[model samples]
Target: MPNPCFSPALAIPAMMAALLCISTGARAELGGTMSSEANSIAAAPQTLLNGALRLRTVTDAGNTTINEYATNTGQIIAYTWQGPTMPDLRALLGRYAGSYLTGAAALAPDGNLHASRVARPDVIVESGGPMRGYAGRAWLPAALPPGVTASDFH
Candidate 1:
């Protein structure tokens, strides 16, 4: 007897592709469109706040708040995150996380990884935590919209 629940369309290759999409969808970041970034924030418990300049704020799990700055074209140009715990950098920084790690590795080793700010040509990340208190922000310099200052993040 054949299994009715099993179909060739749902085979390992197809399943792999689906899984790939799901994983990749969870890592949207700066330079991605707002629609594409939605899935990343959906994984966290968040409250949306609308503001001027088409800006959108998403307060995620814990005290983390992510400010997404979009261009006139509605594409996400930059993102800022701050909270009691550092939100997932892999999800927030996307491809830029690797560069962050590389920068961090070259730090002065002052025993303050969280307190240090890692800067790369493309991505800039700042993090600091004292026990349960943590705060951080990451942004893509090249992607930031014109006249959008870094101070706008907080």
Candidate 2:
């Protein structure tokens, strides 16, 4: 007799459930108030743009360095990352995740999976890199502070 645990029907549903759990457990912070989740994962915060923005740097287990930029009011407005792996968009984008997914899907295939850009009126995400060195940035245009521009994120 075959083992029921190895059955394909059971495995498929189990995988789906695992994915759902993973996604739901991830929190979105973009456009949201500062939360302990960010602080818990990052080192000491640094002020930037002449005190117009706050930057938190964190190195994940994967050795990826992620920099989150927030306003003085504690609202995260942008993120820049570089490492061997890409950061979780679903978690970083918060309410704008759906817009990114839709825009990315609509992009014309350039035959280069290593680079992609989503530029909508509300959000702009540019990510690309080779196998072991990835870099990207995601920011909210409307949330940028006075005299601050997208180039300042990098």
Candidate 3:
């Protein structure tokens, strides 16, 4: 007879709970490693590192494109996202997510969410168009790779 305290039903739920924790905990951070980056997003991205910098690009099922750039040292320094809907900014920005929130909130005090841009010394963000046509890019000025320009993000 199986132990009453360890029923098959209980075991299945326990296994699922463990998996949930593992999956969420694996989310990538701006200054984290490549392995973490691969697991952070829903789909695997094509990655290339040219000794000086690493670039990873992913196009989701909706055809939304997200590009992540990292340094040879493995720290994610910049990200560019353009798609039907804005990719989750918090997941990409890490510690700098709060800065974007604060700056965006200050835009359009009259309650217009269609503002063209939100610019700050640390974070520069711009988005436009409707939900199906949304597009934007956010980056940390201090984090950009040397000799790499903002326009290079496209």
Using all chains and alpha carbons, the TM-scores for the candidates as numbered come to 0.64, 0.78, 0.64
Candidate 1 lDDT tens digits, 1-154:
1112211221223222322343332434766665523453443222223332345667666567766666655655556666665556666666675676666666555433235566689887665555456565667777666566556665
Total backbone collisions for each predicted model: 2, 0, 0
Q: In model 2, how large is the Cα lDDT of residue 104?
A: 65
TM-score, candidate 2, is: 0.78
Give the runs in model 2 whose Cα sits over 4 Å from its true position: 1-28, 35-40
Q: Write the residue-wise lDDT of candidate 2 on 1-154 in tens digits.
A: 1111211121222222332344432333678765534456665568887888988877766688888888887788998888987666667777887777666656666455466667888987777666777787889999999988888887
Q: Regarding TM-score, does 1 or 3 come out ahead? A: 1
| Candidate 1 lDDT (Cα, 0 to 1) | 0.54
lDDT of candidate 3 over 1-154, digit per residue (tens) = 1111211121222222332333222345565554434443444434453465677777655577777766666677667667875555566656766666566555544333333455677776655445566566666677777776667665
Off by over 4 Å in 3: 1-27, 36-50, 60-63, 109-115
- Winner of 2 and 3 under lDDT: 2
Output the lDDT of residue 39, model 2: 51
Comparing 1 and 2 on TM-score, the stronger one: 2
Ranking by lDDT: 2, 3, 1
* Winner of 1 and 3 under lDDT: 3
What lDDT, from 0 to 1, does candidate 2 have? 0.68
